[model samples]
Target: MLLRFTTLSALFFAYTLAWAQQSNSLFFMHRIPQSNLINPAVQIDCPVYVGVPFLSSLHLNLNSTGYSYNDIANGTGTINFPALVGQMHSWDYLSEELHYTPVSFGFMYDNDQYFNFAWTERVESKLFVSKRLMSLFANGNTQYVGNGLVTSNPGLNSFYYREFSFGYSTRLRGDVLVGAHAKILFGLAGLYTKRNSVDIEIDALTHNINARWNPQVNVAYPIGVTTDAAGNVTGVSAGAFSPLPFSLNFSNPGLAFDLGFVKPNDPITWSGSILDLGFIWWLKSTSRFTNDGHFVYRGATPADLTNPDAYIDMLADSINNQVQFQHSNGSFVSFLNPKAYFGGTYAFTPQLLAGAHVRTEWYPGRPVVGLTLSAIAMAKKGSSVSLTYSVMNGSFANIGAAFNIGGESFQFYILADNLLAPFYPERVRNANLRFGFNLFWGCKQKKKKLSIPESSGGGCFWTWGLDQKRKQHGVK
Candidate 1:
C-alpha cells in the first residue's frame, strides 16, 4: 500500500515539471558532442573532446500521457484529487522515465573515425490503477459490494547503475557516414516487478474483502526489507541509495548497442539510428518474491465507516498476517527498452538548417512516440543554437531550445524540451533540461591538407567541401 501511494503521488502531476527523455532540441545540435548519443552517425569537427567528468553532462527528464497539471488546478491554485480523477480515462496509464549522465566524452581519430564514451544512469516507472480501485480506497468498499476492483500493473521500478560506452563513427565514403556505440552496464541497485496483477474483491453481504496479488518482484542490493514467516517479502524497500562511481558489480552486468547511419546529399541530409538494443543480468545479492496465497480482509469487527484509519490498519494487519511471500535467490536477465530515430534535414542556406524527425521508444508498457521539427543557426566561428517543437505521447504543446557558446578549445552547451512546464507549472505534463561542458581539440582545421576535400568537413549540406577560398591572384 505504501509503494502504491508513493507511485500515485508521482502521478498526480502526470509526470509534469520534469524533462522529456528525448531532448529533440539537443539531438539535432550537431555542434555538441551530445548529439552523438542520439545519433551515433553524427560527427563533430573536434578531433578530441573530453568531458569534465561528473560536471560534463547532467540530464533529467519526466513525462506522462495520462494527465496534466491543468486538469487538477482550480482558480485557487490548490490540489483537487476528485477533479483530477474526472480527467482520467479507462485505458490511460501513468508512465515516466529519467536518465542522468555524470561522465561523458568523445575523441576523433585521424583515421576519419570518432571514439566516444560515457557512464549513464536511468530510472523508469509506471502505474495503471483502476478507477474502481481508487474509489474503493477513497470512499470504501461499501459503495461497490459486488464489483471487483483491480490495480493493474501498479509498479515503481528503480534502476541505479553505470554504463561504460565505447562508440565509433566514420565516413564510409563521400555522402555516407556510419557509427555504432556498444555499452557495458553495471547495476548497483535495482527493484523491479516484471509481472504484477492485483484485484480486490468485496463480498456483498459478508463484507469480507479479498485481495488477489500475483507478482514476481526482483531486488538488487535492497535495504529495509522484511520477510514473512515463509520467507516472502510482505514489506518492500523504498528510498534512494548512492552507488560507487567506478567499481564493478560482477553480479549485475548487461550490454547494449547503438547503430546510426547518415546519408549526406545535396540540399538535404538524411539520418537514422536504433538505440539501446540490449539486456542486463542480475546475479549477486539479488532476491525474488512472490505471494504465497490470497489475503481476506473482514475488518476488526464490522465495517467501521466513522474511523477510516482503523479500517486501514486492520486491512494492513490482515494482509501482513495472511499473505506470505516465497523468497528465492538466483539470477535474472532483463532486456532494455529500445528506441528508434529517423529524421531528415534541409539546408536553407550554408548557415541555416531545418529538420524533422520521429522518435519511438519501445517499453514493456505502451510505446512513447513523438514527432519533432527543429532548426539550427550555425555561426561562422563554430557557435550554434537550435529550436524545436515536439508532439509526444499524444500531446502537442512541447516547445524546446538549445544553444552552444564557446571557442574551439572549450565548449559549453545546454538544451531543454518541454520548457514551458516550469513557468506554467500548473498546466503542463512534460519537462526536461540537459547541460554540459567539454574540452575540445582540433575543432578548427589543421594547415595540413588531406585526401578529403576541405569542403567535405562537418557542417551543413551545401557547405561540404566549400571551405577553401582561392588566393585571389591578380595581374601585377
Candidate 2:
C-alpha cells in the first residue's frame, strides 16, 4: 500500500510539473509577506537611506493536504474548483472544503543586518519587506465508471494572491536589537474559467471501461451560476469564480516581531571583531477573513419539493453547510502557530564572519539546522567586497556578496543573495534572485574629558551618583 501511495504521489507531482507549464499567472510562494522573519537587521545608520536595487529568488514548498480516510482508500484526489464537485455533486455533504496550492514566488527588500557605529556602542537593526504570489493547483486521482482502479490527474491554473509588508528594527545599547513588521495581503488576483469542453483520448484501456467517460474539465469555476429561485442549476453562470472553497478577494493584516542580541568581546587574539549571537521568533500569522454565511434557498410555491429546485436546495444545503468556502470579509484569521529560529555569527576577522542558524517550531520535532557558513572579504577600510558561501543542513549551498562604500562621515552598501533567483543557502538551485542595497549617514562625536583625581577613574563609582557633593569635593 505504501508503494502504491508513493507511486500515486510521484505521478501527481509529475502531472503537477506538466500542468504548471501551462499556468502563467500562478503564484509560486506563500512566504513573501513574511520575509522579515528571515533576517531583520539591514544596515542601520542615521535613519534616512535609499538605493535602487532589483532581485529575484525562487524556492519550492511542498505540503500535504486533502488526504482523508476516504482519500487514503480511493487514492488522494482533492478538487481545486468547488464548481466541479458542485456540478458533479461529488463532495460528501459534511467535509470542510480543502484548499491546497503548491509553489509560489517569494521575494523581499532589506533582508539583512545593518550595523550602526554612530553611537557610543555600535547600534544594529534589521528591516525588510517582501511579497509572494501563490499558485492554485489541485492533485488527486479520478475514478472512472466501471473501473475499479484510479489514476492521478493534477490540475494547475492561474490562482494566486499579492502581499505587501514593511518591517523595522534597531539595537538597545550594544547587545539587544528588536524589530517588527506588519503586512497587508490581498489574495485571489487571477481568475480563470473552463466549461463545456471535452477531450477524448484513444489509449490502451487499463481499467476495463467499455463506455466513454466525460473528460471535459473546467479550468476556472464561475462564482455564481444561473439558478432557479429554488437554487437549482439553471444555466452556465459568469463572473468572479465562486464556490471556490478559499476566498481570493480578501485582505489579511498581521504583525510579527523579532529580538536579537550579540555579545562582542576581544577574547584571545581576535581583533576588530567578535562573536555575535541572535534569536528570532514569529507570532502566529493572520489569515484572510471570509464570510461563513451560506446562501439561502428561496422558493415561492408550496409544490417546490418535487419542483427539482427544492431537491437541489436540500443537496446545496447539505454540501454547502458541510463544506464552508472562505469568504472575502475584509478581515483576518491565523494560519500557523508561533514558531522560532535561533542563530549565531562569529567574526574571526574584520573581513571574515562565520555563523549558523537553527529553526524549530513549538510542536514536538527535531530542530533543523537551516544553514551555516563563513563569509570572507578583502578590501581597504573605505571599500571592500565580501563573499559568503554557506550550507544549510548538509546539502544546499549559496554564495552571497556585499560591497560597502565606507568613510569616516558616512557609508553605503549593496548586497546580493541567491544572486541566483530562488536558490538560497538551503536549496541548491531554486529559481528567483534576491538582492538589496542600503545607505547610511552618521556623525561621531569625540569622547568628552573629565577632571578627577589620578587615583580614581573619573569619579568614585558610588560618589558619581551624589550630585552636588561629588561635583564640589571631587574624589577627596
Q: Which candidate number maximizes TM-score?
A: 1
For model 1, what is the alpha-carbon lDDT of residue 173? 69
Please report how far candidate 1 places residue 277 from its true position, in Å: 1.3
Error of model 1, residue 9, in angstroms: 5.2
Cα distance off (Å), candidate 1, residue 346: 1.2
What is the overall TM-score of model 2 with all chains considered together? 0.38
lDDT of 1 at 215: 64
- Which 10-residue window of candidate 2 scores lowest in summed lDDT? 125-134
lDDT of each: 0.68, 0.27
- Estimate TM-scores for all models: 0.81, 0.38
Q: What would the per-residue lDDT of candidate 2 be over residues 1-476, giving only the tens digit for each residue? A: 11222334333422231100000001110012112224333222222333322212222222111122222222235433322222211111110111221211211212223321110011111110000000111222223223222222221223233333344544344323444434343433322111111112222343221211122222222334454464433444445435444453343222333333322333211111111121111111221212222222222345655577777666556544432323221222222223344444444544344444443322111222234233434232324455544342222434555555542234444443334333322222211122223332221213243344322211211111123222332222
- For candidate 1, write residues 1-476 as lDDT tens digits: 42345346535544344234576787667878888888888766555678777778777766655556666655466655566556554434455565667788776564456678887776666544445445565456787677776666455566666687889888776747799999998777677766456677889888778877776778877446676565656566654544553245556888999999888776677889999899888876788776645777665654576778988776677656676667777677777778999998887765688999999977555576789999889875567988899987556788889998873678899888777877876666667778888887654534343233324433442123112211111101
